[model samples]
Target: MNYILSIMPSLFAGAKMTLILFFWTLITAIPLGIIVSLGLLSYFKPLRLVLKFYIWIMRGTPLLLQLIFIFYGLPIVGIIFQRYDAALFAFILNYTAYFAEIFRGGFQSIPIGQYESARVLRLNYWQTLTHIIIPQVSKIVIPSIGNEVINLVKDTSLVYVIGLGELLRAGNVATARDVTLIPLVIVGIIYLLMTGIASFLLKKIERNFAKWK
Candidate 1:
């Protein structure tokens, strides 16, 4: 217990970076995912194929590989970013592909009859999508989206591989320096707290959506 207190500060400092990485990735990925979802739904065959390939490539590869490529591979082309930013860029790109697929699946689950009904009412594509499609899709995908959010919180630790010093890395450093396992425990607690808060908010959203059914 005393050792736990000693490692708290180091764990907390790393957790801050973890939180920042998680939050920004969520913010950037959600909108980008929506856009990618739209592209996948596009009527143009060529555009659809191109986007499909892009998504496939991103989704098929491990995120760690993507991070290594962005951080190290890009430097060969003179696109050097700080380690943190490089990690952030890789995370956003990787997660955007995943979230886009989630959104696409939700959109596909919508009944074709709904689109027909909206068309009968003379609603345009954008209007129908915004009012009719997006709302239903959001509700349908909420659980899955929440899962991704939880995963994102844990994945923030992966950035430490790129030298971001996020929570897991901080815990390792502390453990090495202080010769205590408490730092790892502290890291676990911090992750639990963040995941707990996210779960609470997602549950609230679930409740709100449930009201419609």
Candidate 2:
């Protein structure tokens, strides 16, 4: 018990970094995704094509490669981000593509008649979106978004590849030094707790949205 207690400080520090990356990535990515998804649905052929290409690149490639490219490869082209910045940028960009597709599907699922009805009600574009469209989309995309949010909890570990210490990295370091997997077991438990809490919150959000249906 004392041995485990001794490692808590380092482990908590690593977990703090992981949580920061997870949160800022989502806060930035979700709005960017809403924008990108709208771009994907835009009438302009050029804009659609460009955004499509961007989405294809982001979604088709592994995030680890994206991280390496943004941090390590971009320096060749005069673009450089600090380690944490690179991780945040890559995660936001990658997850934006996914969330864009999810939002696009949600937007498309909303019937056209509703728009016409909103029009008949003299609701302007912003009004319709605010009062009607967004609420429905919020409900529709919750499950998919929940999945990604949970994945982000695990994905935080990937930042270690860029030499940013996170929970997994801290655990690995302690394991190597102590010649035991105890640290790893602790890391696994922390991850499980994080995901479990996320899942519970998502369920609550889903239930709240279900009232709309």
Candidate 3:
């Protein structure tokens, strides 16, 4: 217990970085995903094909590889990014592809009649989307989005690959230095607590959306 307490500050600092990555990725990626999904659904065949290829590349590759490529490989081509920026850029691009697919699925699941009705009522494209389509799509994709968000929590640890010490990395350093697994155990517990809170909040959001059904 004393050992755990001794390392709490370091672990907390690492966890703060992890949360920063997670929150900022969510803020940026969700909207990017939406825009990508809209592009995928666009009438322009060339644009749709390009976006589709982008999504395929992102989704098909390992995120760790992507992280390394963005951070290390890009510098070879004269594109340099700081470690944090590299991690964030890779995470947002990778997760945006995933979220784009999820949102695309949600958009397709909507009945055609709703769109026709919106058209008949003379709702402009933006109004129809904001007032009708988006609400229903949000409700439908909540569970999938929540799952992705939880995965994002875990994935933040990958930032350590670029030497940006996040929670798991901090624990790893402590374990190596102290020659004990206690720090790792503590880190796991903290992760569980964070995920538990996220799950609970997601359930609340789900319930609120359920009222719309």
Clashes of each: 0, 0, 0
Number of the candidate with higher TM-score, 1 or 3: 3
Q: Tens digits of per-residue lDDT for model 3 on 118-142?
A: 9999999999999999999999999
lDDT of 2 by residue, 1-97 (tens): 9999999999999999999999999999999999899889889999999989999999899999999999999999999899999999999999999
Residue pairs in collision within model 3: none
From the highest lDDT down, the ranking of the candidates is: 3, 2, 1
The parts of candidate 1 lying over 4 Å away from their true place are: 1-3
The TM-score of predicted model 1 comes to: 0.94
- Which lDDT tens digits does candidate 1 get at residues 72-168? 8999999999998898899898889999999999999999999999999999999999999999999999999999999999878777778888889
Prediction 2 global C-alpha lDDT: 0.94
lDDT of each: 0.89, 0.94, 0.94
How many clashes in candidate 2?
Answer: 0
RMSD after CA superposition, every candidate: 1.4, 0.8, 0.8
Model 3 TM-score, all chains together? 0.98
